[model samples]
Target chain A: MTAKISPELPERLVAAALAALERGEDVGLRALARDTGVSAMAPYRHFRDKDALLAAVAMRGFADLRDQLLAANAAPDPREALVAQGQAYLAFARARPALFRLMFAGHDGGPPPIEDNAYGVMVRRVRELAPVSLEAATLACWSAVHGMATLALDGGLSPDGSSVEHAALKMIVAGISAAKRS
Target chain B: MTAKISPELPERLVAAALAALERGEDVGLRALARDTGVSAMAPYRHFRDKDALLAAVAMRGFADLRDQLLAANAAPDPREALVAQGQAYLAFARARPALFRLMFAGHDGGPPPIEDNAYGVMVRRVRELAPVSLEAATLACWSAVHGMATLALDGGLSPDGSSVEHAALKMIVAGISAAKRS
Candidate 1:
């Protein structure tokens, strides 16, 4: 009998894990099985264990975010690029709050096995665009945008009350943009 | 049977939880019980559940942070105050990474209820000292410092082996201070 590989298996598995996370719960093997359209034991045969599955899920989240960031920054205008990136950041946080939480929740069973992860890609992009040191640009861009998303999602800033987060994003983008003038 | 009161109960429980977090773990109740010298089940009586205890832990974290922010802003010199606040923010993030995470982690149970509990105090202080709108000052100061801290902790900017976190904090502080100046 020829062993057939399931092309949708990985995608379905990750989707399930992310869905569980979206509900603000842990995504162990059983949960993943339930979330996906496959048999419970089917994931075990593929992923080895929960940690392996989680690692894969985390990588998928990062990759998805990276793609989103790239798309947002693909705007023709540099100014629009920044705003697009900020809006994309907010959208990602709002859309996948749990996955967003997982990305930085810092649950390091070990350093992610993958080299040059999502953060590496983000930092590289910032360095490519700005004259500042890689670290400076990365810190400037990530901190401002990440901080806004975090506060908004974590209730540090109100989303419904005052448009405070919206205003903050504009100011932060302005502040970072003003860096070039300096 | 007489109802027992452990005056030291709250502090001990909090210390245990914070230590578990600082040590880098999920911080379950069993560990807290051992660390706090209470029965494993004891905390449930004092706190409705793990989430309740975590909420208290987050509250204490914010209170301590507020005290530090107040000290920073109270510096005799204006510029010095800015630096102090930024330094204090960094210190808080480093000293209590787990509690810091809990403050904004938005865990499965729910986000810690400390947002309305303590953020108002900090915003009120920012409004009094800075000429900007309360929303502006709050976002300017909070996002600037918080942004820098997140970058440092996530290893996004420090990959080059320099403490770019410190630099980022300085830049954010400068940015906010400059805002105040203009």
Candidate 2:
């Protein structure tokens, strides 16, 4: 049992941390260890501090986000796929506001290197359309979707089912396609 | 002299609150009253609680943001003016991140009624180009700019003067124009 449980300690601690954040409670290393039914020192062995544990939780968030994006990317049309991805992104943020905020927090010195995660999913779809100005198009798309999600979380956008968000996503895709032409 | 000084007490307390937020300190009514050299109970004359004081500070932030938007709207070309307005919005978020976050926080139940503030300023510009789809166009434009500002604050965008941000703004404007044509 020690052999089986010892290797799973890190995963258990991270799960506890994620649960804490989901419930809108401040997470700490000691609290996580207690919640995970482990010696306080056990968490320290797996994670240097609370930041390390939070980082692990954030990674899980990114992976979950990427999966949603992948599922949303199944549309036959490239443009529709992008819009679906945006909707998926918004849904993820809304469903996990605390985790979403935590995932993007404290990315020091530069943009978070999210290329291997959800961003790469967005990039692949963006590249299919705006290959020439790929970087700008991708940034614009991400900014709009992220902004919508952030606003939704902050009560800056309507809480009800928003046709407004749908139309805005279409306008962004149309705008990028227009830019390509010009 | 008492009459003159008494009226300015709320403003002085608000200034103190703003200062504390700027310095990245948690603010309290007692602390703000102390900072303003007022008796602790004196604040209750103007503000019911800390939330009321913070609300005043957020109001001041919105007014300041409107002023910046008004300044940025002075460009000769309408599209140029909109892009400039977005840059100013981003600049405001970066300059006063804590205050910016506070301005948008706890706006429960629905989107904050910002029609009289910065949102009104952007709506006027968006009206010029997309008169038909005004609601959707305005939301898209606001979402894009707001997202960019939020991203810049969260280090999701590069810290150094981002050409990507500029290019993204241009694409959004261009996209809205294309939507209008269609």
Candidate 3:
């Protein structure tokens, strides 16, 4: 019976959890196990607890977000690429609000590490624009983009299309460049 | 019996709800009534439901936030005043994480009207600086400041003092100004 257990159980659990989040249902290990048609105890084999399972789901969320950012980074002009990335960030948040919220819920006093994820992608582009003040510029760009994503999620932003988002991103990019020159 | 009811019951209930949130407890009307030592049905007289009660608390949060922004806006330099406002926004979010989240949770589509709240305060400052593209500039500034505050709460931001936040706010201000010039 042990040998019969599928090696893909972990992936299936994660997929089920993602689906649960998409449906706005609370994701618990036991609930995921039931959703995945596994024994209640089966999930414990892969995840130490619910937090670990949710962390895996968040990891997958980050990976998907990174892919979106990478695709958005294809513009030839560095500034255009950066703006595209910001747009992609907002789109992802709007498309997967539950997952986006979970991704940044901040366990242990901070979000999961970002060096190898979407942050890294945006940071590289910002470095190209503001080499002199890389840290501040990167943080500024991220704060503006992330803020826009959050505000959109909570409906703090106007529903007047992406014009405001577009303009805001351009301002941050331009601001960083100008500050660097000065 | 109606005359025996305390006129301040509603205020007491709101205070109890605020206390519950501060202690990281879920704010249910019944629970708040219990905490306030009132009959369960008594709360219903003042609040139609839990959301109504919570909305009142969120309103108080906004009022407190607006006051902080107002106080921060007293700097003599327009630029410095704006930066101080951003700092105050971040401080408010950090000081009251639960209340801050509740305040922006957005019901019926958008956050409570912003024209008469903290947003109105910031928008006035942004208008003073970037009068040309007033709408875009205002959104950009709000997004940056709000983003920094949210990130700080979720541990997405580094805990390295306020330098990064300061720089980010400055970059946004400069960015809006540069965009206006060009």
Q: What 10-residue stretch in candidate 2 chain B is worst by lDDT?
A: B106-115
Alpha-carbon interface RMSD for all candidates, in angstroms = 4.0, 2.4, 2.4
What is each candidate's DockQ, to 2 decimals? 0.42, 0.53, 0.55
iRMS, candidate 3, in Å: value is 2.4
Candidate 1 CAPRI level? acceptable
TM-score of each: 0.79, 0.84, 0.88
Please, what are the lDDT tens digits per residue for candidate 1 over residues A90-135?
Answer: 7898888877766765545624322244456455455545556445
Off by over 4 Å in 2: A1-9, A24-34, A37-49, A107-115, B1-9, B25-34, B37-49, B107-115
Clash number for candidate 3: 0
Q: Please give the lDDT score at residue B44 for candidate 3.
A: 86
Model 1 has a clash total of 0
The TM-score between candidate 2 and the true structure equals: 0.84
Scored by CA lDDT, what does every candidate get? 0.65, 0.81, 0.81
Clashing pairs in 1: none
DockQ result, candidate 1: 0.42
Model 3, span A67-114: residue lDDT tens: 999999998788999999999999999999889878876645324535
Worst 10-residue lDDT window for candidate 1 chain A reads: A110-119
Model 1, native contacts kept:
0.37
Candidate 1 chain B: 10-residue stretch with minimal lDDT: B173-182
